[model samples]
Target chain A: MADHKTKASAKTSSPSGGEEAYVPPALANLIGYYLRIAQEASFQAIRQGTGKSDLKPGWYTLLTILSENPGVTPTELSKLCGRDRSTLTSTLNGLDARGLIARRRKAGDQRSYGVKLTAAGEAMLRKLQVIARAHDERLDAIVGKDKPLLMTLLRRIVDELGNGYPPPPARGLGKTSRTR
Target chain B: MADHKTKASAKTSSPSGGEEAYVPPALANLIGYYLRIAQEASFQAIRQGTGKSDLKPGWYTLLTILSENPGVTPTELSKLCGRDRSTLTSTLNGLDARGLIARRRKAGDQRSYGVKLTAAGEAMLRKLQVIARAHDERLDAIVGKDKPLLMTLLRRIVDELGNGYPPPPARGLGKTSRTR
Candidate 1:
């Protein structure tokens, strides 16, 4: 429906004017529908702003979390990202290969290590953050003063829906010693 | 943050209680951050409810569109889904392989075909819709009377952000003859 970004007046009408707007019948009123579309637009805008196609969908989330909570173990990172540990390991490997993150063994726990973004990762994140902020600015421009409420609403949806879903796999991390 | 869904009180506290809540400082306030989380939850919920792990993201959107716009060309489907043509073809092919949708050449335009759901496709969609409606009800329970307002807000965000992004690739479809 948004394919014609330039033709503001033709929001519905095709170029030939042979058809009316195609409002997705079942999807028009669904919250998930809007969430999917809006998220796609937000992601595209950020990708365009960053000019970096190499970073996959969840990379920024990983980088941001690492930036805030440095040296979080793989299991902890998996829980935070809602991704399985095996997938998380490969993602960490990709970042590590790019020299963006490093894994270091904990002083007492010789078997387990923590993942943290390296100086290079920090630089990449700084660059990405500037672009992300600009994207947020565009979103802010749209929502204006309702931004906080929108954030709350969005968070509420996440919280309520996630209430009874399967917990992220802690695997061999054990019940008592699971990383926070 | 939502990894411990089974323990309602542990929204922040881990089992050990040895650590305080770990919040991604920068992402906590961002709209896209919440959107990503909420979308992930919504997708997971629908996937679990439908019991179909193979549908893949965007497949439902395509099926929904085909269910509504019975004769939309591949190009039109691509624009509606915000995906490029090549990727759209593969998705359509997947659905075709599953006997869910059929492509019929348009009358007088043998070169072009309209994509629509088959009887089996319609049956599958009916089953999925029930699950999706339940998911939407959960969203409704969360937002209540604000559902309409939330929808408007989400649409506004989609429209405003989509204003100047690159148009979905409509290669060879031509500007004036583009399908609606």
Candidate 2:
């Protein structure tokens, strides 16, 4: 077993006149490293701009989904978010406890519940959307006018990752179609 | 305050029956989301492939850095990784304890120490790199032939995000010197 407590000492004199050393660039460009840093920065900004008491990004996603769909079920929310059903359940529970959302049993199915935002939840989501928009703008500003291009490229990458292929062109308005 | 505990309960539901709820297309397209899912999948695979005891991604990075530049410093490592200096301190302590790296005082600098990987560290890095290559191949297979294009697009996004300009043209050839 690797020793869990050994500290690798320096091989040369410290640049700072003390013993603090640095790592190299080999690790810098790794995709995971970049993602972690970007995510952390975004999350920190969101937490600070909005009160920490509000919905986190995951929770906010659920709220946004419900708002758009009106009465989405928990299972649907799970699939949409790519979260396990178990994780969505707990996240929903937190939202319900905070009065940000409510889950009521569907008309016929005792096991299925329809989720929607409460008054407080709606207010919170509205406020959060404002913060999110501002944060996104800041992020866009950081990337400058190339934001659209960046978004397109990212979307292409994501689309490639999933099984779905890009859609074919819409039906018949071309010269051949008119002849037909 | 949000009930953190209740959030845990939401995770227990079954996910089989809900309609395909709408995910905000815009959110789905964000680079952050794809980067996150990809990283999560990679890390999970690493953990599973390595069993419970092999060095994880961060540790592998540290070792790689040490092997590449034998006398780097902890503060430099933290900066390169975008991790907090304090966090690097703890992680370095763990690596040092494991006898995979060594920390030695610089000849002239009293306050900074240089870091290097031990022979054990080199061997471990080689092993992990093999695993990582396999892992990356799996990911590429998951994404299909678009993997290269996806990586290229992601690299472009990072370049645009970290620096507000389009990437410079390939090395050694000025714009005027190139044949169109």
TM-score of 1: 0.77
Best by DockQ: 1
Q: List model 1 lDDT by residue over A1-180, tens digit each.
A: 234554432333222112222358788999988887778667766766655466554577789999888999998887666554666777888899999999999999997899999999998888778777877887888888888778888877876776545443334333353346
Model 2 per-residue lDDT tens digits across residues A1-180: 111122233211111111111323553434444444455445544555554565576666767778877687877676776566677777777888898888888998888989999999999888777777776666666555655665554443334333212121222333332221
Least accurate 10 contiguous residues by lDDT in model 2 chain B: B10-19
> What does fnat come to for each candidate?
0.35, 0.08
**lDDT of candidate model 1 versus the reference:** 0.71
Each predicted complex: what DockQ?
0.31, 0.07
Regions of candidate 2 where Cα sits further than 4 Å from its true position? A1-24, A28-32, A51-55, A162-180, B1-22, B26-55, B68-80, B85-98, B103-114, B130-180
List where candidate 1 sits over 4 angstroms from the true fold: A1-22, A53-57, A165-180, B1-23, B53-58, B165-174, B177-179
Over B1-180, each residue of candidate 1 has an lDDT whose tens digit, in order, gives 234443323432223211222348788888887787778667766766655455554566778888888888987786666555566777788889999999999998888899999998998787777777888988999988878878888888777666545443333343464345
**Best model per TM-score:** 1
TM-score of predicted chain B, candidate 1: 0.75
